[model samples]
Target: MKIAIIGAGNMGGSIARGLAKGSLIDDSDIIVSNPSAGKLEKLKKEFPGISVTNNNAEAATGADIVILAVKPWFIEPVMRELKLKSKQILISVAAGISFEELAHYVVAPEMAMFRLIPNTAISELESMTLVAARNTNDEQDKFILRLFSEMGTVMLIPEDKIAAATALASCGIAYVLKYVQA
Candidate 1:
């Protein structure tokens, strides 16, 4: 299955590496795109097997899975330009964006959405990632959960509680790190 990542920054880079190097996905099956060519080049140097693009729609085209790895403010316009197939599953990692809102923005309402909140520990493969299915079927939800499971443990939660879960799971990581530093 092909996977496309919309941004290749720190978090996006980590997730791409985890999928390719962690044996969850093959290099040939992964594609990434970013508005910043520098970041795309950086990822290319590290993982030469995958493809990179400046066009978000081109990167996402025909992929079985698409990751919305860009910043929150850029999501709507970017997704508007991209066309998602009915079979395509979107995994949104944008902070402060809710699933219902995301569903309204995508080209395909029938396109499945999975909400995930993963902490920084994912870089070390020690993350507690929360997964929530949004107006999706069992097959699509499982498909989304399976992808995040590659980076860390999965906790299924309701979409309404995902923002709260993000606070506890995402922000809480920094607090834990502060405790460690003390």
Candidate 2:
């Protein structure tokens, strides 16, 4: 399966690197797109098998899964540009964006969508990733769970609980670290 990541920032880059180390998807099947070439170049150097492009649509085209890792402010514009198909699974790692907001941004509201809240620890392959699904079935859920499980522990939560889950798993990591230092 081809996975395209739109954003080469911390979360996106870490996910790409983590997936490259996993056995589920091959490095060659991963495509990363970013407006800036610097991060893309860095990722290409680290994982030569992966494809890097400046065009978001180019990376997303023909991809089975499109991960929107850009800043929340960019989500609407990016989604508008991609015009993602219903067959593609949309996973957004941006915090604070709900399923309703995401559905509004996309052309196809009925498409499978998920919100993933992964802590900063994802860079170390030890993130507590919280997942909230919409319009997805058992098979898709299992696939997503397995795919993310390769990076770290994954929990499937209800959309209503995403905020609470994010606080406990995502932001909680930083709080724990601060306490440790203190």
Candidate 3:
């Protein structure tokens, strides 16, 4: 399956690295994009087989799945710029963005949109990623969970509890790290 990662930042980069290292996805099947060439260049150098580009549209085009790992502030703009396809599944890793908000941005009411909140542990393929969606079918849900399972444990939760889950699973990791450092 072709996967496009928009935003080669921490979360996006980690996901790409984990997917590549796990061999769950071939490097050639992944495309990573960022606004600047610096980050994309770094990823290309590190994961030579994965395609890297500065054009978000280019990265997202015709991919089976498109992951939005950009900062929260940039999500809307990126969505507006992306030429999203009906068959493509959209997953957002941005914190605080709701499924409804994402749906509005995509402008495809029937589009399957998922909210995935994974902690820094994703870099090590041990993240507690929370997945939530409103209208996704069982098969689609399973597919997403399987895709994320490559990185770490995945839990399907109610959309209403996404914030709490984010706090417990995402922020909770930082808290543990701080305690360990202390």
Candidate 4:
């Protein structure tokens, strides 16, 4: 499946890099885009098989799965440019954006949107990633779970628990760092 990562920062880039390195997806099948030319350029050099771009819409154009990896504050702006096809699954690692709210922009009746909470430990392949499905079928849900499984163990949780999961895994990454610093 063709995959697009909309934000090629620490988390997104790390996921792409890990996927390619692990042979979970062919580097040629993966696409990455970021606002920063420097990061995109770096990504190009780091993963030569993946196409890196600055256009969010272009990055997501033909993607079967699009990862909305932008920061929480930037989700609205980024989501504006992304047009998720009905077959496309929009997975956001962004904290706090719920599935119901995310479906507002989804034009596809079969649009499969999800919220995930993955800790920084994913870089080390040790993350308790929380996943939630919205308007997704069993087949699609299993497919998504399989994809995330490449990064680490995945758990399908209730939509209500996504927030705490986000707090514990997403924002909590920084919180844990603070303790390490202390």
> Which of the numbered candidates is closest to the native, going by highest lDDT?
2
| Residue clash pairs of candidate 2 | none
Estimated TM-score for each candidate: 0.91, 0.95, 0.94, 0.90
Report per-prediction Cα RMSD to one decimal: 1.7, 1.2, 1.4, 1.8
Off by over 4 Å in 1: 179-182
Stronger candidate by lDDT (3 vs 4): 3
Whole-model lDDT values for every prediction:
0.81, 0.92, 0.87, 0.81
Cα error, candidate 3, residue 43 (Å): 1.3
lDDT of 4 by residue, 136-178 (tens): 8999889877777877889999889887777776677788889
lDDT by residue for model 3 over 37-135, one digit each (tens)?
888888889889999888999989979999999899998899999968768889999999888788778757678888888876776889888899766
**Span of ten consecutive residues with least summed lDDT in model 2:** 118-127
Q: Taking the tens digit of each residue's C-alpha lDDT, what string does model 2 give over 88-149?
A: 99999988998899998787999999999886566567878889999999999999999889
At residue 175, what lDDT does model 3 achieve? 95
